[model samples]
Target: MAAAAVSSAKRSLRAELKQRLRALSAEERLRQSHLLTQKVIAHSQYQNSKRISIFLSMQDEIDTEEIIKDIFKQGKICFIPRYRFQSNHMDMVKLASPEEISSLPKTSWNIHQPGEGDVREEALSTESQREKETWLLITKWLRNETEEGVKTWQAQPLLLKCQSN
Candidate 1:
């Protein structure tokens, strides 16, 4: 009976630790979000990237919509990554406009996803001509502190030549 009791206690401790870890993760996400916002805004590459491709943030570290809104305001061509089932890889989809993003499909976790029609064929053609571009993927630290997380943003933006329409 004593051994069983000890085992139960260990399980309880594990559960508590897991819960605390989740909370810490949440806090870290918030910190990274703030820092990433500042970094993306201040980074010269981000400001100069006329046609930028970004992977959608899966973590709470950054909210993709907020970032998109700021880029939209600057009149930059923003492309967010979408999971392509057939390709088994993420495909960057060009957003028609910021106004249409709110209407995107939502997953069970309430994550917004790009619909099939949101992808522009012309953009795909353009992307095919160029290699992968420099991008950012924000990450968080265990302590939830800004600048403590990973520097996912590239220092220099990749150059690509697109055929004129």
Candidate 2:
């Protein structure tokens, strides 16, 4: 009974949050996303990391195009998730340039995903050897409270492990 209640609560909260995010105006969303990108770019972890795994933004989420461009500008490798239907999992594909992203097809879920042939063998091998290094994963969170006050939505970097081995 407790588990069921918790699950229900979580579902309701997620729906409410998604609605709130959808309500954000284009200008406000762009402003917040730019600020968030600036924060990540200025962080030492992002600066030192050689490879980063970042998600392509949906219509309602923070736009990561600027961050991706900056990463390439800084000579860092950028990767995005390419879902595999047979394995029911995602693989990281090296994104050499921002323009390449548009050439990919959209998944059933309406998110852009790289094709199976887009995998980079070199990146896969290097990921295993760099397990000890910090890698950035860009993600979004809702209703998080900060030192200043409550924030409705935020995009931030989360440290993640490399499972390429």
Winning candidate number (TM-score): 2
lDDT of 1 by residue, 64-146 (tens): 55667787888877776666555656566677777776687865546566855564633344655365343433333333334
Quote the lDDT for 99 in model 2.
Answer: 89
lDDT of 1: 0.58
**Model 1 per-residue lDDT at 14:** 64
Best by lDDT: 2
- Estimate TM-scores for all models: 0.56, 0.76
Off by over 4 Å in 1: 1-21, 25-28, 107-110, 117-165
